[model samples]
Target: MSFSRIAFTVTAFFLTTSALTHAEEGKFTASPGLQLYSLRSQFKLKGVSRTLDTVKSFGIQLVELAGTHEMPIPEFKKELESRGLKAVSAHYPYKRWQTEPDAVAQEAKELGLEYAGCAWADHKSPMDEAQAREIAATFNQAGAALAKVGIKFFYHLHGFEYQPWKKGETLADLIIQETNPEQVKFQMDTLWVVFPGQDPVKLLEKYPNRWDLMHLKDLKQGVATGSLSGQTDVNNDVTLGTGQMNWAAILATAQKVGVKYYFIEDESSSSESQIPKSVKFLQSIRW
Candidate 1:
C-alpha cells in the first residue's frame, strides 16, 4: 500500500467512533461536561462551526470554554447556543482575571456562564510563600468582584503550585486556607494535582468546601513528579479510564463535596479518538 494510504488508514482509525451512537443518550451519569480546550487543536483545524458541530454530535451538553477561536464573544456565544451546547464555565487568561476582572464578569455574563475562572496563576518558580500569598490576595479580589455580579469565580489548579511551603503543607494549601471560601472557589484538574505527586482526594478532603468545580483529566503512568515547572507535553494526556488515576474514588469525593460541574479535559493530539472512549468510560463507572 502507498504511504498516503497507510496514513489515511491510521487517521481514519483514530477519528472513527461508534457512528451515531457517539451521542450515547445520557450515558455519562456523573457530572457530564467537556472542557472545550480538549479540542483546542480541532477548533484550530476546523472552524468553530465544524468543531462544535462535532461536539454536539458527541452528545456533550455542558462545556467549559478555553477561548472562542478569535470570534467576537457575542458571535461565539450565539454559535454555541445555536448548536445546542451550553458554556457552563470558561477559563480566561490569568492576567485578565487579575487586571480586568470587571471585563471577565461581563464576558461570563454575556456567555451565560454560571462560573468563570483562570486556569493558571503567574508566579515565581517553586511559588514561594510570599508569591502564594500574593496570588491568594488577587484571587480573593477577583473572586469578590466576580461574585458581586452573580457569577462564581474559581481558580483551576495547575500542578506546579504543589511545591511544599509550610512544614507539612504546600503552596496549594495556603491558597485554599487563605482565600475566603465565599469569594474564591477552586476547580481541581485531577491530572495536574496528580502530576505534581499531590493526591486529589486528599486535597478534596482537606478543603472540601473550597472546590466548586473540577477538571477530570487522567495522566499517563511513570511521569516524573515534584517539579514546579507548571508545563508538560500535552500528548501525555490519555483516555480517562486507561490512565493512572483512581476515578471512582475521586468522583465519589467530588460528588460528596457538592462540586457543581465536572469537565473532561483532553490536551492530546489523539483526543478525537480518545474522547468518545472517555465519555463511555465515565458512563461505565459507579460508586
Candidate 2:
C-alpha cells in the first residue's frame, strides 16, 4: 500500500471504533445534577451568585453543596431556592457534627437537604490507625443523630479510604460494614475510586442500595497513580465522555441498584466549559 492509503486505512479503523462507542452511549440516561465543587475557581473569579447563575444556566435543578462560604444556612438555602435550585446534599465536617450533632442536623433540615455527608475525614490533624478508628466512631454516632431529624448521612470517599485496614480489609470496607446502612450511606466518587486502584463497578455491586448519591467525576490517564496521596493536579480531571472510565457499565450499575442521584463533579479549572460538554454527552446517552 502507498503511504496515503495506509494512513487512510488506520484512520478509518479508529473512526469505526468511535462510532461503536457512541452507539453504546445511547444505552444510558443523563442526570440533571451539579457538583458544587466544580465552580470553586469560577466562584472565586466572579462571585457566588455569578457562579451559581452559570450552574443554573446549565439546567441543573439540584446541587450537592460543598461548603457554604461561611454564609448562613438559611441565607444560602434562600439564594439557591430563589434561583429554582434544590439543595439535595451538603458536605458536613465530622468534627463539627461531633461537637454539635443537633445543630448540624437542624441546619441541614433547615436547608431542606435530604442528605448530609463528609467529603473526607479529618486527615489534616495527623493521626494513627487507632485515632482514625475513634474518628469513625464519632462519624457513625453523628450520623445516627442526623437521621433523627429526617436527614440521611453519607461518607464521601476521596481515595484515601482504600488504604488497607484491619484483617486485610480496606478502610472503605470497614466503613461500609461499621456504619448502619439505614442512617449512614456512601457517595462514591468514581475518579477517587479509580485513583485508589479499586474498581468502582465492583464496589457499587458489593454495597448495592448502600449508595444513595454519587460524584460522577472522570480522571485522565498519566495524572497520578497508585493512590490519592500522590500529588495530582485538578487540571488532570476531565469531562465525562473524554476520560478513561467505563462510563456505560458504571451508569448501568448505578441504575441497576437504584441510585437516587448522580452529581457531575468537574474539578478541572475549565469547569464552565467542560461541564456543558459533559452535559451534552449525557443528553445523547441512555440506559
Candidate 3:
C-alpha cells in the first residue's frame, strides 16, 4: 500500500477504537439521578447542607426528593440550586394526592419538580381489585390536577400491588388498566418489582408508555420472591451490580420502553458507601 494510504488507515483505526471505548465507558445512557430518601439518615445526622454536600461528592447532579428536610419549600429549592443539584421528581403521601392534589401540585411547583408521585398506596394487606380501582381513581384525579400545573403525576410501585386479581392478571395490572394513560404514569422501582416475583423487562414492555421514571434499586441475593407484603428489611437493599438483579437486561429493556429518568435508591444503612459503587456499576454496564 502507498505510504499516504497506510497513514490514513491507521488514523481511521485509532479513531474508531477511541469512539468505541468512549461509548463503552458510558454504556448506561439514562444519566442516573439519586433519590434523596436514600440519604434520609444522613440528613438527620449531618443536617441538609452537609448531606447535600455528600450527594454532590457522589457526582450526582440530579435528585429525586422525598421531602425538603423540613426546610421551607422555597428555601429548599434555593439550597438545591446553590449546590448545583436539581430535583427532577418527588414523592408525596397518597392521602395528600387524594385529598389535596392541588396543594401537592403547588408544593411540587414550589420545589421546581417536573414529576411528583406517591411511593406507596395505602391499602389493606394483599391489595384487592376494589382498592386498586380506588387508587387508580385517585391517581387519575391527582394526575389531571398536576398536569394543569405543568407537572406530571406518577406512582412508584411497591411489591404489594402484585396481588392476584383474575386469570393471569394482578392488582397492578388492574390499576394500570383503570388509570388514565396520559394523566397518570408510573415509576418502576426495580427492587419492588423483583421482590414481588415479577420481571421488570416484561412489565416495562407490557406498559411501555406508562413508565416514565425508574428507581434503580436491587435486592440482595437469596431474598425469597413472590411476596405481596411490600415490606422488607431495608438491609436487603444492595449495590446495583452486586445484587441478584440482571441489570444489563433490566436497563436495556428500560431504555427500549422509553423510561425518561433513572434514580439509584439504596435504602440500606450502608447507602453512603454503596451508592458510589452503584454509580460505577451503571457507568460500566454494557448490554
Q: Who wins the TM-score comparison?
A: 3
TM-score between model 2 and native? 0.85
Clashes of 2: 5
Screening candidate 1 with a backbone cut-off below 3 angstroms (N, C-alpha, C), the clashing residue pairs are none
Error of 3 at 221 (Å): 1.0
True-structure lDDT of candidate 3: 0.92
- Per-residue lDDT of candidate 2, residues 59-169 (tens digit): 888899988866787778788988999889999877786788888888888888899988868774233466557657877887888889888988887877667777866
For residues 1-287, what per-residue lDDT tens digits would candidate 3 score against the true structure?
99999999999999999999977653578778999999999999999999999999899999999989889988888888889999999999999998999999998988888999999999988677789999999999999999999999999999899988899989999999998898889999999999989999999999999999999999998999988899899999999988889998888888888899999999999999999999999888986
lDDT, residue 275, model 3:
98
- The stretch of ten residues in a row with the least summed lDDT in candidate 2 is 123-132
Which candidate wins on lDDT? 3
Query: Can you write out model 1's per-residue Cα lDDT over 191-264, one digit (the tens) per residue?
Result: 88888788889889889898989888888877786556777889889999888899888887888777888888
Local distance difference test scores for all models = 0.85, 0.81, 0.92
Regions of candidate 3 where Cα sits further than 4 Å from its true position: 1-26
Q: Please give the ranking of all candidate structures by lDDT, highest first, separated by commas.
A: 3, 1, 2
Give residue 273's lDDT in candidate 3 (0 to 100).
98
Query: Distance (Å) between predicted and true CA of 263, model 2?
Result: 0.7
